[model samples]
Each structure stands twice: as C-alpha cells, then as structure tokens.
Target chain A: DTAVSQTPKYLVTQMGNDKSIKCEQNLGHDTMYWYKQDSKKFLKIMFSYNNKELIINETVPNRFSPKSPDKAHLNLHINSLELGDSAVYFCASSQGAGNNEKLFFGSGTQLSVL
Target chain B: AQKVTQAQTEISVVEKEDVTLDCVYETRDTTYYLFWYKQPPSGELVFLIRRNSFDEQNEISGRYSWNFQKSTSSFNFTITASQVVDSAVYFCAPSAAGNKLTFGGGTRVLVKP
Candidate 1:
C-alpha cells in the first residue's frame, strides 16, 4: 500500500487560475507537511500540521494556504497562480511533531504555471 | 533556525565505483536530528537514515555508510560499489524545533553502467 498518496501527479494551469492538491497518508501519522522544490531542486518547508492543527507556516506567499481537515489529510490550495509558483510540491507525514520521526513523502505534484 | 548544505551539486560515477555525498549543517539546538533522503527520477522521496546530534558514530547499512562528525557539523553518506540502481538525488536535512525539516540543495548521483 502507498503510504503517502497525492492527486494530480502533474498540473498545468495558466496564471490567475486557482488550483488545489489533495494529499492523504494511510500510516496513521499525526503530523503532515508541505514542501516545495524549485527549479534548482532546492527543497523548502512551507507548512506543517499536527493532528489537524497548524504548527509551522513558513514565509510562503499569502496565495498559498494549507488545510488539514483531519490528521490523515493535508491539502494545499494556491490562488492566483503565478509563474514563480511553478515547481514540484511534495506532501509528507510523520508520527508526530518534534518526536524524531522519519517522514513518509508522496510522489509529488508537479505544478506548471504558465 | 537550522540549515543544511550539500556542496556537490551533481556527481557521476561508473558502476562499481565508490561515491560519497557531503553534508554540512548549522543549528543552535543542542539536541536535533539529521536525516538523509533519496529521491529517484520517479519523484518519490525515500527515507534513508537519521542521526541524532549527540551521536557522532559512523554507521554502515548494507552498501551504504554514514559518517557523522559533530565537531565539523557534517553528516556524509557513502555508497560502496555504486550500481545503476543507485542513481538518484540525495538530500541532507536538519530538523528544526518543531520537526520541520530544512533540506539542502540535493546532490544528484548518476551511476552509469
């Protein structure tokens, strides 16, 4: 079974379009996170949710928001997509926050904002 | 605030060669965690290993080995007898207070057969 799964492995949209990427983990973990990998393959954390509560929010733009309705799911929604937002986004989950747990990551969603 | 840096951008080695990826990190927390992840062309990030801040011991698992030195704040990974299947981008990361991972600019390894 896939531990972490996400929808729309690839997304192609124009500027000003709003889109969402859904993520789910079956590992019954308590913490979920969103990370962005830019063209240079630089990975940065964007958000983190522990048991559906927001824990860490990085310096991402306001257009990007993450919602975790439950402990098993964390979704990212981007509004007014800009060219700079084009990158691969990965969803990950861990056992808990600051508990020295290894993360299980999804296959990632490659978003292209034209 | 924690940061991780992997100096080698990309490395290409022939099969059966030994390859190492270097990682340097900076953090104020006396107790923290360091991790290594492998991302293949398929785009999935696979967890490799994790080391604690206080443990400077070197570890070996199968064909993989990790040498962690706290004095230099470096956690290095070495692959013995590299194979084509070993081709992937390796990331070194440090954990913040909230378990937030700061990943280094990955080092892509391409082992040609």
Candidate 2:
C-alpha cells in the first residue's frame, strides 16, 4: 500500500487557468505539508497543516491555498496559475508536529502552466 | 533562521564506487534535526536518515552510512558500493522548530554501469 498518494500526476493548463491537486495519506499522521520544487530542484515549503490546523504559511502568494479536511488529507488549489506556477508539488506527512519526526512524501504532482 | 547547504550539485561515479554527499547547515537554535532524502527519476522522495542534535554518533545501515558532527554543524551521507539503483537526487534538510524543514539545493548522483 502506498503510504502517501497524490492525484493528477501531470497537469498542463493555460496561464490564467486554475487547478487543484489532491493528496491523501494512510499513515495516520497528524501533520501534512505541501512543498514546491522549482526548475532548479530546490524544494521549498509552501504550507503545513497539523491535524487540520494551519501551522506554517510561507511567503507564497494568496493564489495558492491549502485545505486539509482531516489529518489524512491535504489538498492544494492554485488560483489563476501563472508561468511561475509550473513546478512539482509534493505532499508529505509526519507522525506529529515534532521537527525531528520523519516525513513520508508522495510521488508528487507536476503542474505545468503554459 | 535555518539553512541547509549542499555544496555538490552533481556527482557521477561508476558502479561499485563509493560516494559521499556533503551537507552543512546554519541555525541559531541549539536543538534541531537533520535529515537526508533521496529523489529518483520517479519523483518520489525517499527518506534515508534522520539525526537529532544530541546524537553525534555515526550510523550505518547496510551500504548507507551517515555522519553527524555537531561541532561543524555538518551531517553527511555516504554510500558504499553504489549501484545503478542508487542514482538519485539527494537532499539535506534541517528542521529547527515547529517541524519546519529547510531543504538544500540537492545533489544529483548518476551511477553509470
């Protein structure tokens, strides 16, 4: 069984189109996160939810929003996607909100804004 | 502020050759956690190892070994007898507080048979 999974493995949309990526984890973790990997392969944290509560919100624009219906799911929605939004979005989960805990990541959703 | 730096951008080696990926970090907090993650072409991030600040001991798991040095704020990963399956992009991440992780630029390793 895949511990962490995300849908829409590949997405290609227009510049002004909006898209959403769904993520689910069966690890029964309390914390879930969304990370963005740019062309340089630099992974940056976008948002984190601990038990459905917003914890960390980076400098990401308001266009990108993360919603976690429960501890097992965290979905990312991007509004008016731009060229810069073309990157790999990864979903991850951990046992708790502790910094030392290991994280299990999904295969990732590749978003391409044309 | 916490930062993880991976100096090597890419490393290519023949099969069975050992390779060491360097990681240096800077953080104000005395207590933090360091981690190593591998991302193959499949785009899945695989957790390799994790080391807490208090644990400076070196650990070995099969062909993978990690060295954590608090004195230099460095946590390095070494792979012995690397195979083609070992080719991947490795990231060094350090988490300070609130479970926030800062990932390095990553080092891509290509193992040629």
Return the top candidate by DockQ.
Answer: 2
Task: Assess every candidate by TM-score.
Answer: 0.98, 0.98
Which portions of model 1 show Cα errors greater than 4 Å? Answer: none
Q: Residue pairs in steric clash, candidate 2? A: none
lDDT of each: 0.94, 0.94
RMSD of each candidate relative to the true structure? 0.9, 0.9
Docking class of 1: high
lDDT of 1 by residue, B1-113 (tens): 78888999999999999999999999988888999999998889999989998878899999999999999999999999999999999999988777899899999999999
Tens-digit lDDT track of model 2 for A1-114 = 999999989999999998999999999999999999999999999999998999999999999989998889999999999999999999999999899888899999999899
lDDT tens per residue, model 1, A1-114: 989999989999999999999999999999999999999999999999998999999999999999988899999999999999999999999999983789999999999999
Fnat of each prediction? Answer: 0.75, 0.89
